[model samples]
Structure formats: C-alpha cells, structure tokens
Target chain A: MDTIIQGKAYVLGKNIDTDQIIPAEHLVYSLSDPEEVKLYGKYALSGVPPEQGGLPQGNIPFVTEGTFHSDYTIIVAGPNFGCGSSREHAPFALQVAGAKAIVAESYARIFYRNCVDGGFVIPYETSVPLTGVIKTGDELKIDIEANTVTNLETNITFTLNPLGDVFSIVRAGGIFAYARQENLMAQS
Target chain B: MAQTITQKILSRAANRKFVDTGENVWLNVDILLTHDVCGPPTFDIFKQEFGPDAKVWDPEKVVVLPDHYIFTANEHAHRNIDLLRQFASEQSLPNYYDVGTDRYKGVCHVALAEEGFNIPGTVLFGTDSHTCTSGAFGMFGSGIGNTDAAFILGTGKLWEKVPESMKFIFEGDMPEYLCAKDLILQILGDIGTDGATYRAMEFDGEAVYSLPVDERMTLCNMAIEAGGMNGIIAADAVTEAYVKAHSSKPYEIFQSDPDADYHSVYRYNVRELEPVVAKPHSPDNRATVRSMQGTKITKSYIGSCTGGKLTDFMLAAKILKGKQVTVPTNIVPATVLVARALECETWEGVTLKKIFEDAGCSIALPSCAACLGGPADTVGRSADQDVVVSTTNRNFPGRMGSKKAEVYLASPLTAAASAVTGKLTDPREFL
Candidate 1:
C-alpha cells in the first residue's frame, strides 16, 4: 500500500448515518450475487436528499451510476460519520462507490472497524474539522506515515492521529489477508 | 493495578494478564449472533473466503435468527430466511431459529437473553449494532460487520481494540413515570451522540441497580446510539438470578475494581430527571416530555430490541388500560416467549395483550416489524407528512417509512399516552 494518497475531496456534514449511506430498502439485496452486490454501489447515499436532511438540493451523485471515479477518492466529513446501523454495507458501498479514504473528525466505532477490517477504505481521524476546511473537488493528499492531510488546492495542512495497528491491517489489504499473513489461520 | 470490568473481560478474552486501552489484541469469541438481514451476507463471505468444505469452528456458538425483515411477505425478504435455513441445515447448526417454526425466536437480542446465550463475563458479538444489549448481563458485547463475523465463523476468533471506560453513576430515587429509557435520554442529551465514541459506558449506582434486568437491557441497547462501544453493568444478585433461570451455561462473574481508572465519570441525580423524548432527526436531540407536550402524532409504535421487552409493554398497558388510542398504534412483542408471556400474564385482571387490544392498539406478531421501516406492507409505518411517536431507537429522517415523515422517540409510557391524546403526552398525567 502507498504511504501517501492523493484524490479529490467530497465533503459531507455531521451524523451521516448508515441508513443514508444505504437505505433499509436496499438491504434486501443478495451479497452472493455479483449483480446485486453492485447495486449497493449504485444506491450508496441514495437516502440523502434535500428532504432527508442531506446535501442541499440538486447535488451530483457521489458515486455516479455505480461507476468508480478516480476523481472522487476521498470523502471529508464532520463528527459521527456512519452513526447508525451496524451494516458493513455503509463502508462497502462507499468503497464500491470509489472512496479510497475517509477523513472525519470522528467515526462510529463499528463503521471504523468495518472500514479497517474489510479494507473497504482508509479511515482518517483528524482533530481539526475537515468539513469546513475542505470542499468538493479540492485536491487532497493524505500521508499516512506523516499523519497529515494536505489540501493542495489551498496549500493548508492538517494533522491526523496515526491509526497504529489498524494501519498494518489496511496495508495488508483487509483483515483476511492480514490474518493469513500473520499465520493466525490454520492452513487447511 | 485496579482494572475496570471492560479491561478485565478483554484481558480474559485476549488471554493476557492485562490489556490497556487503544491496544489491539486477538480475541477468542465466546458467542456470535447473526440475523436474516446480515446472516446471508455473512454466509456469503464465509463461503467466499473459506472454501465450501470448511466447517464452522463451533456450531453451538454461532446463533442464527431471522427477525428484522421476516414479518413481511416480500419475496426478497423470504429469500434471506431460505438462505439461512439452507446454511443452517448444511452446517447442522444447533442454534438456528427458523421463522414460522416451533424453534422460531423473535428478535435476536431478546432471543439471546431468553436462550441464556448472554452469560456474564464473556465476550459476545452480533451482526446488529444493538448487540450491545447483552452488556446488561455484565458481558463485553459489541457489533461486528459481516466480514468480521465471517472470519469469526471460520476461525472462532477476531482482533479487537481495548476501549477506555466511562463510569456513569445515577444517584437518588427514580421518579415513578421515569424508566431507564428516560435516564438514558437525559444522558444522551447531556453528552451528544458521539460523547462516548470508542469508549465503554459503565452504568451503575443506586438508580440503575434498582431497576429490573429487562429495563437494564434497554439502557445497554441504546448505548450504541451514543457511539459507545458497549454499555455494561456488573453482574449482581439480580443478574445471577436471571441468568440462572434462563441459561445453564457455566459462567464466571466479574466486577470492576473499586479504584479502577475511567476516562471520565458522570454522576446524575435521577430524582430531578423528568420523562424525556428524543426529538425529530436525532436521538440526542432530547427534551422533557412536559415541554414537548401537545406535539400531534399520527402513529404510535411500541416495539424493537430497545423498547419491546415485557416491562415496556407492562408500562404501556398501565397507561392505555381503559383509553382507546386516538391514532394508529402498533404493539409488537420482542420474542415468541414474550408474546406467550403477554398472553398469559396479567397486571390486575386483564391480560397484557387484552389491555393493548381493548385500548384500540393493534398487536402484531413478535418480530422487528416497522422498527427499521419494513416493506410497504409493514404495520405502523408512517405515511408521508405523518408524525409518529415510537419506542424504537433511532428517529432519523426516513427511519420509519417516508422521508417526509417525522418521528419522536420516547418510552413506552410516553408512546402509549401519546397514542391516547394523538400528541406527545406525559405519562404522569395519565398515572
């Protein structure tokens, strides 16, 4: 895994819940079917409309029609990101929607673990609020080893807490890979 | 060194003498739970990661219950249960509770307790976030994703970080109208939704211990709403009696040291606390019921792992005994056992279900109906522009049925009373 990552930032506000990430209606999809799993990417953030206390009206889709976009790789958000539901689909949907990393003030515990264990996305915790500092389409560079997120658009830098052992799992490409590498799983 | 109960349990699970907060360690899981909503996905991951020939590490430890979307007649919803049935049959799992069968359990959380899987001083993980509800038994209960659950399914172990502990001591005598639900809402209001993020909320002191185990479960059930890793109470005589009657599993009871270190300590006087409600859009947006009185409601829901326990219905039945609900009100028992108990048990002379039915409330089957805003046919789902007072946990936009519908979260007393007046009403007035 690269120690430094650069992408365009998409900003969201506080208390972005799992229902908003992927509504209960979409939860009926079968994960075994590749076609159904792809629907998660398409419906990612589907519940977040102006009427549902999300981005004001007429906002562009974060993940356009389930197609991964290299431009929208980073998501910047305020505190309590992924606040409701224990669904790993929230992070999985964000991953399938082309989110390489998430920079938030704080995250709900289950979402944080899901992102790390599933290698869905790199979760970055920052003391400084990122929602106000970063904007949509801002070029952002995250340096994991240096514990800093630099906004190339404005030339401003923000400090981030090192994820410690969690970074090791991320570098190994999810928990299954890490467990295999560590010989935690007995060879069949 | 004095260790908190959270620390003690983690150390045991990790097989270490001591584990500090923020340190990650591999933990051997004791109990793992999954339901219809997440079970099929977890099984898919299990099969994808581990070959079809691979068997579960321990079939007895993995429990499968179809609860969340089972009440609906949707084909997709029924398909999830079919997958679980197939998987359980293939694995020969002894704990699978199939829907519409003699072995059917209602909600997974309630079933876990009734089946005695919530043994004290053990680590419990579930696919649903409210898995923290087991913490009422003094266990380290937390929610895990499908992938992690799959890993545990195959290997019987997973890695976890030791969380810091926050002690909340509720002092003074609790008021009659106030339940554990009100106390927790007050705590949520004092500390915002993320106040206890990545930390354990250890509830204790006079007021908490004075309540019944069912009510204590309600407190732990919503700890996730505050972003708490888990909510726990030390196993005392009350807990021991309940566990002994429900389960035969051998268990060790653990307690926090007298001088254990906590990240922070909050002391609340329950005597002055009033009945509170979590207003529209947020669980932490709490206000006293008295202040929010007369806010009209179009529906009333009294069910979920959080508020569908036997105690919750008993309280609601007390308020709705003779009065008819002015709006559409739905009463769902949390489990089949609870449903049977409701049918057989009576407060004065009338059965609990009779009390609810006589009050013009529709009693639904024991399932997670309308809690997560089920299919179009789900009972008690609010219509667009409708306002509902529900006993379920979250009240976010579109949480029930329509994004345009508003939801107010309150205790069963408040919900039942609100159903009578077609608005938010204080339970004390009816009492």
Candidate 2:
C-alpha cells in the first residue's frame, strides 16, 4: 500500500450511487476474466448525468471516450458518495479506471467496506467539503500516515478523519490478506 | 441491560449477553444470500482466497437465487447463471434456485422470505442491498459486498459494527390510500437519503404493528435507500404466523427493552401522511403524489424486491380493477411464487393477474425485469428521455435505462393510478 499518493482530482456531487459508478447493465460481465475485467474501467462513472459528471465545470467524462483508463486518478466528492447498492464493482471500476483514493464528506457503508475489504482504493472522509474548493483536474496528494490531502495546485491541505480500526486491514491489502496476517485464516 | 431489538439480535449472533452500539464484533452468520449479479464474482473471490478444491464452510447455510438478468439475450447474463449452477453443483448447496427450472425464484430478497430463510433472531447477509428486507422478521439483515460475502462463504462469520437504532413510531390507523410504501417514503422525505447511515431503523407503534408481514417487509426494503444498516421491527404474532406458515423451524422472538437507547426518535401520524413519490434521479427527492399529479409519464412499472410482492399487486389490482391504462404499464411479480399467486390470488372474484391484463397492462414473467434497468431487452426498460412511474426502489440517473430517462418511484396504488392517466396520480384519486 502506498503511504503517499498523488493524482489529478475528479470532483462529483453528493449521492453518487453505485449504479452511476457502474451501471447494472454492465454487471453481467465476468469480474475474474482478464479481458472482460477491463470493461469495468471503460464504463466507470459513465452513468452520471453529463452535466454533473466531472463537477464544477461538469460534462467532463471521467474515463475519456474510446479508452478504458481515466486521466484523473483522485476523486473528491460531496457527502454520501456511493450511497446506493452494495456492488463491490463500483470501487473496483474506479480502481480499474486508475483512481487511487477518494476524499469525500462521507460514504455509504457498503461502498466504504468494499474499498477497504477489496483493496480497490483508499476511501478518505474529509471534515469539510472539498468539492467547491478542489476543482476537477487539480493535482492532489494524499498522505495516509498524516491523514491529510493536499491540493498541490492550490497548495491547500485538508485534514481527513483517521482510518482508525480499519487502517491495519487496509495496510494488509484486503480482508483476505489481513486475515492471513492475523492468522485468522489458514494460508493456502 | 437495556437494548434495542437490533442490539439484542446482534448480541445473540455474537454469543454475547450484551453488545454495545458502535462496537465491532464478529457475528456467526445464520444465512448468506447471493444472486446472479453478484454470486459469480463472489464465488471467484471465495475460490481465490480459499483453495480451489475447498468446499464451502456450510452448503446448507448458503442460499443462491438467480433472478437478475434472467430472460435476457445477453450471453454474459446467461453465462452468470451457468456459473451459479456450476458452483452450486460443486458445493452441493441445498438452496440453489436455478433459472429455466421449476425451482427458479424471481428475486433473491423476496425468495428468501418465501423459502423460509427469514427467521427472527437470525442474522442474514446478502450481496444485494435489499437484503435488509428480511429485517421485517425481527432479524438482523444487511447488505455486504462480494469480498465480505466471500469471506462468509469460507467462514460462517463476519464482523459488523453494532448500529445504534433510530426509533420511528407511526401513530394512528393507516389510511385507505396509504400502504407500507407511503409510510417509508414519508420517512425518506423527512430524513433524506443518508438519514440513517450506519444505523438501525426500528419501526414501531400501533400502525406499524398492524401491517402484515408483507407490508412490514416493504418498510424494511427501502431502509437501504436511507443508507440504513438495517430496518427492523420486533417480531409479533403477525411475523410469527408468517414465519411458521413458511417454515417449521423453531425461532425465538426478541423485542427492544423499555429503556433501550436510540440514536434518535421520530414520530409520525399515518392519518396526516399522504401518498408520495420519489421523483427523478434520487430516492430522497420525495413529493406528495398530489403535488406531482399530472406529471407526464410514458410508462408505468410495478415490480422488484421492494414492490413486486403479492400484497403490492393486490394494491395495484384494487386500483386497476376495471380501468384501462393510458400508457404502457408492466406488471412484474417479484418471485415465481408471486407470479403463481397473481393467477390464484383474487379480489372481488377476479384474479390479480386478470385485473392487470384487463386493464391493458402487460404482465411479464417474474424476475427483476427493468427494475434495475438490466439487459437491453429488459421488459419495461425506459427509452431515451422517457418518464416512468415505477413501483421499484431507487431512481438514480440511468437507473431504469436511458441516461436521459427519468423515473418516479411510487407505491403500487400510485403506479396503477398513474398508469390510468399516463401521468403521476395520487392513489387517493382511485381509492
């Protein structure tokens, strides 16, 4: 796990549900097949209304057309991000699209758990709203150890809530790895 | 040692005398539910973590129901069913509901109830968010992601944070126009989408207790819409009767202590509540059906784990008895049993199925058709810029297909009334 992560930001509004992150229509694809798994990246966040996709200016696609990976790697959003559905595919799609971390006001429990338990991406909760302050494409760096995210473009840093009990699990990569680390499961 | 029903249930699952709210504790899961959409991926993870030849911790404890994406031409969707069959065969699971067979069930959540998987004092975890629907049985049920589900597949246990419950007491008798859907929507409108995040929503009061098990399930189904960990109601005679009718398994009932602690308490009078709809793109964007009346709609759909139950159909049948729909309306039963019930269940000497057919509504084969806007060929899926009034939960953008399309979530009565006028109509108009 990377302690210091940096990337361009993709900002979105509140209540950005799992459906929008990865539409149900595309859920039919196999998650384990190497070839088919890439499709998750292709359609990541494709369900957000065009006018609210990338936020601030809006209408900006998170994953560019005719491509699988996204240019922006960090997501900054309003409260209750990933508020609907319990699809692990949402965070998996984001990770496949190159997002490393998300700094939001809050997140739905299932999505949050998926992020850590799947080792897909780091979910960071901010004390204050970062949507208005951080524009899309703004270069940002997250310091996991310090629990802070800095907007390199504006040189502004925001404190994030501590990862607390789940940090060790996150550090181990995912629940399976964490279980192995703690001898909770027999290693195959 | 006062505790809410949720805490008590968790305590029992944890093998503890008491479990404090916000305390993370490992629970012995009684049942692990999965469906087509998530079952395959979960199996993949389970195999990857556990050895390739390793069997499930307990085949009897795992319930797999293939409902989503059924009846679609999409090869991937069909492939998912094959994967489920393969896994079930390998694991020798006793509770696998396959598609294209008499054993098939429409939706996982509803099927769980019909198959007697829902029992009070038990803990259930499913890959689908609507798993909370089982909380109506006075059980602890919450949705988990594939990773967590996979963990449970290998071990019959998973850790969960004890949720501080929020008490919602609905006073007065439920009016003629109101159903469980209206009561839940009323709460959504007040609390917004994230109102109950990481918390238990315990429904109480005389009005809540008066509802049948099916209606109680409706109230709990939408708890996820409010970001609730679970929505629970104490098991009473009604819940007990329903459980006993479906299963011979012995079960214990638990209730919140008199001095139980709660995160918050909300009071509502059913007499003052009205039929409501969650308009365009969000479940929290609620409006009274009367206020949204005449809003044009191109389609009306009644179905899903949330709204496709027999009781929901009964409500719709009452509204569509002798009326012709002005738009394309689709009636989808939540499960195979529900589909059969529509044929046998009657009101005023007319079966529920005939009521919809006579009203110009198309009754589709039971499955989660168009509720989540599945495959391109999904029945009742919305078209570009199409406005639909549906009995399904969630109206997020592109939820029912067509990114430009809009969905208004309403009760079966409101959906049927709206179908008659090709617009959003209050159920009170028909009642």
Candidate 3:
C-alpha cells in the first residue's frame, strides 16, 4: 500500500465492460504462469472498439502493440465502469497491464469486489465524472491517505468517494491477507 | 421487523434472526458453482492461498460444469478442462461434470436446475455472473470473483452486503408473442444497465407466476445485466412441482412479507408489452422489435444459458415450423439434456431437431458455443461488420466474435422471425 500513487492517466467513457477490459478470446491464457500471464497484459482493454479505447480523441490503445505493460497507470472513467461479467480476469488484466488506480463515478458490484478482493487495482469512486477532466497521457496523482486525486496537467483536484468498508481489505492487500490477519482462516 | 424475501434468506444464511439492508455479514453458502473459464484460475488461487493439499469445504456443495470453450481446438481451453478434472479428482468432488464424459453439462446455470442443485431458501454463489439465475427458485444466488469463490471453496463462507429490494409486478396474461425476454428487456430499457446496482429485484404478479420455471430462470438470468445482486420469484406450486420432479432433497420455501419494504416498485401490464430487443452494444439499449423491423442482419443465433433452454427452442420452433431462414441461423442447446429434449419434444407433431433441420437452420452440439465469442473456430461467431439477431443475452461489442459486428438481443421468437427475412422482424408478423 503506497499512500501516494502517481502515473499517467488513461481515460475512458461509461460502461467499460469486462469483455472490453479483456476480450473473451484472450481469457484462455493462464493468470499464474509468468510467461502466459504476460498475454493478459498484452491484450488488456483490447476489446474496447479501438475508437473508444482511450478517452477524448479515442483510437489510442491502452497497451502498445508488442508490449505487455501500459505506460498509463491510472484510469479515469465515467459512471458504471466495469459493468459486465464476473470474470476476475477483467481487473487482473488491468493490474497486469500496470494500472494502479481507477477513478470513476461508480462501478458494477462484482467488478468492484474483484478489484479489492483480488488486490489488483484500487477502484476509487469520484462524485464528479473525471473522464471529461482528465485526458489520456495526462499525469495524475492519487493520495490514498487523503482520498483525493489531482490532475497534474491541469493542477485540478477532485474528491474521491471513500473506500469505506472495503478499505481495510484493500489496505490489507486482498481478502486472503485480511482473513489471515483476522484469523478467519484456519491455520494449515 | 418486516423483511423482504432477500433479507429473510440472508438472515437465515447468516444465522441471525434479522438482517438489514446495507449491513455486511458472513453467509454460509449452500453451493459454490464454477465452470471452465473461471474454474482453473479459481482453483489455482485456492491452492496458492490454502496450500497445495487443501480439501474443499464440502465436495458435494461445489458444482463444476465444463461448458465454455469446450468444443474449441484451443489448447489452453482444453488445458483448463484438464485442470478442473485434476482438482476435482484430488478433492474427491462428486458434483464435477467433466467434458467428454456422460456427466458433462453444457451451461452451469441451466444445468444447476436440471441437476437439482438450485433449491429454494438456500444461498448459492458462483464464479459466473449468471449464477443469479438460480434465484428464480426463491433462493439467494449471486455471482462473485475468483477470490471470493476460492474463499468459499476453502471456508464454505463469504461476506456480502445485504441488498435493498426492488419489486417488479407484471400483471395480466402473458401474450403469445411476448416471452420473458421481452419483459426483462422492458425492465432493462426502463432502468438502464446499472439502475438496479447492488439491489435485489423481486418479480411478482399473475404473469410472472403463470410463467414456467424455465421462463422465470430467464428473468433472473439477466438480473446481472441490470447490476442486480440477485433476482427472485417466490416459490409457487409450479416451482415445487419442478423441484420435486428433479430432486429429492429437502428444502424450505420463503417469501416476502405482505408489508415488506422495497427501495422501489415497478408495475407493468403484460398486455401492454410487445416483443422487444436490446439493440447492439449494450443490454439496456432496448427497442421494440416492430420499431426495428427491416434492419438487415447477417446471422441469427439462438443459444446460451439465457436463451438455449428447451422453452426457448420451443418458442423458436413455433415460428420456424415450415419456413426457411433467409440467413444463417444456429441453434445450440444449453445442456445435453436440452439437446436430448429437442429430439423428443415436438411442435406441430414435428421434433424440434427435425424442424430446425428442415427449416435450413444449423443445430450445433450443446455447449456454450459462440455465445461469448469463443475461440476462432467457435460456431456461429459473427464475422467482420456482420449484424446478428441473437437470443443470447448481452450484445456488448465483440461479444459474439468480431468487434466490428453488431448483435441485437431478442427473444427466440424475434430471432427466428428475423432469420426468416434476413432482417429484424417482429414475431407478430409471423404469429
């Protein structure tokens, strides 16, 4: 848990579904095998219809061709982000592609759970839509301790909704870690 | 305290007398379902977190159905099935339905009902989003990610925030042309995709009860599309008859109290509703089939957990009895049981299989083929810029195969009728 996280932003429109996050075709690869796992990163957000892949101008790829990682580590989007599917692969792909945080108006429930429970990316909800304010390739900083995101390009700051009940789980680095700390799982 | 049916079920699962909406509780899960797509990773995480030799919380309580990507030549897909087999064997799990075996089931959601795993008053959690389909049987069923599913696999328990309930009442007799697909699409159009987020949708009224169990499953199956935590219909004699016919396991029935509270209630008259479709790119992008008529389509697909059931096929068969499809149409059953039923079940004294074949429609072997744009070799996958009218749920971009393609999510009636004209056609045109 780094309190201050900063990176280039990748902005997207509303209802960025699981299929668009990681296309169903690329879901066959292993999430654990180090070599196979890179495929997840290579194809992350590959189904976003290209024109809608990146915000503002669109047609910008989230991950560059032939690379497993993305230069943009923060994703800023509109409401109802990650609205379809329960594939944990959605968030895993984003994390594998080097996304550190997501600032959106809201999220689909299962996707939100997967983000925290899997300790993949920090899904932060904002009261205002950030997709319009942040441009792809714009620098952004997320202060987890302060619960605010600042656009380094515009020097504008926005308040993010508190992580609330799931914050401890996210802070503990996922359910398994939290469970162990709370002694919820029996020792082997 | 007057609690909604969902609250009551959660209360029972949490071993508490009452559970309030918005409060989190650790629930004793009745069943944890998984399939090939998510099962391998979930099993891997289970081993990584719980140790290599850890046994499941309860073997019988976990159901693994290998349906997705089963027929694909993709080696990774095959490897996933092998992993499921390895894990199931290591844990001595009895509910494992392996591919290439007699016990193989196609889609996990529909198969859960056919195999008697969906019992009322119980709580089910699965790795697949459509697991909420089981909630049709007056149970609490919701989807979770691999982490939560693996947690349940290891502990038989997981945490959940009790959802507020939303009531939907559909009155009057269900019209012949309108099926559950239309009714659900109507709701989606009204509420939009994320309207019911973190809420329980309860279906009621004469029309809902008049529907067969399979139709009810259709209503609940797409609850996830609305971002609903679960969709439930109280158990009636019809539910009991179906459950009794399928399983001998004892179960409890629960219902919402007469004075229960709901976040909101929506009312509709079945007579006022018409065949509708969720136009391409989004499930909430709904339009009346009549309004979208004459829209040319390249293909028609009828299959998946949502639309591949026997009742769905029966509806399609009614419209395609003697007509020839002008476009390529694929009929894939959700389960082997459904495939067998198509051979025996008759419409106008003709078996559905013969009807589809005679109508020039291709009937593929059962499994979730092309519903999710599987491997390149998947059947009925949409080609570049191809427009498809499909009975399957979710018409999201690239859902069937090609990102350039578009899909119109409609009832089997609409899909079949549209297939006849190679254009989006209202079922009423043929009915």
Candidate 4:
C-alpha cells in the first residue's frame, strides 16, 4: 500500500447514507455476473444531487458523471458519513468511482468496517474536522504511516488516527487477501 | 475483572476469559442472516473470493430470506430472489426461505427470532442494520457488510471490536398509552442520532424487564439509528419463555457484572413519557404528539421490523375497531406468524384484519413492504408532496419513497389515531 497518497478531494455534507451513496434501486447487480457488475460503477454516486431522477431533494454531487478518474479521488465529509444500511456497495461504489481514501470527522460503524474489510477504500479518522479545511478540487497528500493529511494547495495539515489492523488489511488489498496470506482459509 | 453483557458475550464467542473495550478479536459466529437485497451481493463475493467450487463452512448456520423486495414483481427484484435460490441450492443450504411458498418468512430480523436462530449468548450477524433486534434475546447481534458476511460464510468467523457499554435504566411503571417505540424514540431524541456511536446501549431496570420479548425487539431494532453497535437486554423469564417456545437449540444466558464498567448511564421514568414522533428528514428531530397535534398526514403506515409485530397490530386494532380512517392507512405484519396471528386474533368478535379493513385500511402481505421503499410499484410507498405518519423506524429524506415526501415516525397507537383523524392526533384522544 502507498504510504503517501496525493489526489483531488470531493467534499460532502453530514449524514450521507449508503442509500444516497448507492440507492437500493441499483443494488440488483451481482459481482459474479460481468454484465450486471458493470452497472455498479456507472451507477456509483448516481444519487448525488443535481443528477435528475431518484429522491426529490437531491444531495450535493461530488462526482458529476458518477465516475471518478484522475481528479476528485479523495472524499472529505462531515460527521456520521455513511450512516444507513449495511450495504458494502457503498464502499464498492466509491472504490469503483476511484476514491482512494475518505477523511471524515466521524463515520457510522458499518460503513467504516465495510471500507476496511473490502479494502475498497482507506477510512481516515480526523481528529480535527476536515469539512472547512478541505475543499473540492484541492490537491491533498495523505501519509498513512504518519497519520497526517496535508493540503498540497496550501500547507495546512490535519492529523488522523491509525485504524489499527485496518492498515494491514488495506496493505494486503482486503480481508480475503489478508486471510489467504495468513493461511486463515483453506488452500484452494 | 467485571464484564458487561456485551463483554461477556464477546468473550465467550472469542473463547477468551476476558476482552476489553477497543480490543479487536475474531469471533465464531453462531448465525449469519441475509436478505434478498444483500444476499445476492454477499453470495457473489463468497463465490468470487472462495472460488466456485468452495463450499460454505456450514450451510445450516447461514440463513437466507428474500424479504425486502420479494413482494414486488419487478424483473430485477425477482432476479435477486432467483440468484439466492440458485446459490442456496448449489450449496445445499438447509435454511433458505423462498417467497411465494409456505416456508417464506417475513423480515429477516423478525424471522430470526421466530425461527429460534436468535439464541442467547451467541453472536449473530445480518446484512440489515435492524439485525440488532436479535439482541433482545440476550444475544450479541450486529449488522455487517457483504464482504464481512462473505468471510463468515467461508470461515464461520469474523473480527469485531469490543465497544464501550452505555447503560440505560428505565425506572418506574410505564403508562398504559406508551409502548417500547415511545421509550426508544424518547432516548433517540435526547441522545441525538450519534450520541451512542460505536457503543452498546444496554437496557435494564424495572420497566425494560417488564416488556414482552417482541417489545424488547422494537427497542433494540432502532439502536442503529442512534449509531449504537448493538442494543441488548439481559435474558430473563420473558426471553427464556419466548426462546423456548420457538427454538430447541441449546443456549446459555449471560449478564453484566455489578461492577461492570459503563461509558455512561441514563435513566428514564416511563410514567412521565408521552407518545413522540420523529419529524421529517431525521429520526432524532422528535416532538411529542400532543405538541404536533392536527399536523395533516396523507397516509399512515404501521409496519416494518420496528413496529410491525403482533403486539403493534393488536394495539392499532384496539384504536381502529369502530373508527373509520380519514387517510390511507397500510397495515403490514412483520412475519408470517404475525400475519397468521392477526388473522386469528379478534377484538369484539371481529378479527384484527377485519377491524383494520373496516376502518378503510389496507393490509399487505408479510414482508418489508414499503419500509425501505421497494420498487415504485410497492404497496405503501409515499409519493411526491405526500406527508405520512408511519410506525417505521427511519424518516430520512427519500427513505420511504420520494425525497419530497415527508414522514413522521410514531408508535402504532399514535399511527392509528393519526389515521382516524388524517392528522397527527394523540392516542389519548381516542382512548
């Protein structure tokens, strides 16, 4: 895993739930089916606001086309981010959308665990609130080893708490790979 | 060292004599539950990571129920169930409950209790947030993501962090008009949504123990709304009687030590509480029904794992016996057993269904019908510009349907009285 990650930030508000991350309507796809799985990436963050259809009062859209490429790779949000539902698709959607890491003031437990278990994205817990400090389209450098996030645009830096075993899991590319490396699962 | 109920349960599951807060340990999961919405993705991951030829650790330990969107005829919805059935058959699973069949149970949380899978002192994981409902049985129940669930399917074990415990003591006698829903809503209102984040909310004291198992389930079901890891009540005669009636599985009960460490403690005198409602867009934005009296409602809903139990239906029926509903009301039983009980249950020589139907209310089949807002064709979903007073747990924007629609979360009694008046009327008015 890269100890230092530099990417553009995507800013979101408080209490963004799994439903809003990837609505239940788009959960019909199966990973085993190639055709169905392709829809997941396309529908990623499709519920974000200003995008027509679904949910009358839409939320602020971080990724306009629901696809994250070179720009807008890190998500910075307020408290209780990813609050509803136990859908791993929330993280999978963000991972497929190219979110390298998420720096939030606080997170709902299930969403936090999903990100770590799936190794889809790195969840950074910020001791200081990042909502006001970080802005959309800002270049950021996240150092996992130092637990520090620095704004490359300005020289401001925020401290984050190490996620204990989560660092190892992300380094190994998810729980499945970690388990296999430790011989926790039977050999195929 | 003294241990709380959560500590004891996790210790036992981890096969350790003791475990402390913030410590991560691998636990042997006794039961893993999944539904249509989450099961397919979980199964997909299980197959992909474990390889196509890999078998489940124990088929009997895994329970699959196609509940959430099964009632709808949408092709995608059907495809979800089809995939679950295909996977269950491939694994030769024993506990697969198919919809449109007699074995079909309703919501996975309710079924987990009714089927005896919620044994005390064991760890249970489900793909839905309300899986904490099983904690009412004195078990350690929490929700997990598809990846973690897939790991459990292959290894029958998953990692967990021991959380600090928050003890909530409900003292004094509960008033006749109040139920578990009001008590929990009151707590949520006071604590705010994230007050109990990453902690276990342990319910106790005279009032909590006096509640029936089903009512206790309602209290634990909404713990997730407060951002709690789980909500648990120690096993007592009430819990034992319910578990014995439904399951013959061997189980053990655990309790917190008197010196158990608690992050915080809260007390509530049930006698002073009233029927409260969580207003539009947030479960913690609460107000007493008396204060919000006459707030117009376009529809009324009495269902979901939180409020769609036999006790909830019975309470609503008592208020709607002879009254006609002024708004469109939908009554959904949480489980097949609850639906059957409603059919056979009578008040004033009329079945509960008859009373609801006579009051101009419609009853739907036993599933999570419109609680999560299934397909657009779902029976009771709220439309644009609609204001609904419902007994469902969440009132988040676009939770029931249409982000423009407003939802007021309430108890069944409050819901019934609101339906009769087409406004948020206090149940005490009808009583």
State the weakest 10-residue window (summed lDDT) of model 4 chain B: B395-404
The complex in candidate 3 yields a DockQ of 0.76
Clashing pairs in 4: none
CAPRI class assigned to model 2: medium
- Ten contiguous residues with the weakest lDDT in model 3 chain A: A179-188
Better-scoring candidate (DockQ), 1 or 2? 2
> lDDT of all the models against the reference?
0.88, 0.93, 0.94, 0.87
The order by descending lDDT is 3, 2, 1, 4
TM-scores for all predictions: 0.96, 0.99, 0.99, 0.96
lDDT of 4 by residue, B1-431 (tens): 99999999999999999999999888999999999988988988898988988899999999998889877768988998998999999999999999888999998899888888989999999998889999999999999999999999999999899999999999998777998999899999999788888899999999999898889999999999999999999999989998899999989999999999999999989988899999987789899999999899999999999999998998899899999999999999989999999889988899998899899999999899888776878889888889999999988777887767889999999999999999999999988
Model 2 chain B: ten consecutive residues of lowest lDDT: B422-431
Better of 1 and 4 by lDDT: 1
Q: Could you tell me which residue pairs clash in candidate 3?
A: none
Point to the candidate with the largest lDDT.
3
lDDT of 2 by residue, B336-387 (tens): 8999999999989999988899999999999989998999999988899999
Compute the TM-score of each model's chain A versus the native chain A and list the values: 0.87, 0.97, 0.97, 0.85
Docking class of 1: medium
DockQ values of all predictions: 0.65, 0.75, 0.76, 0.54
lDDT of 4: 0.87
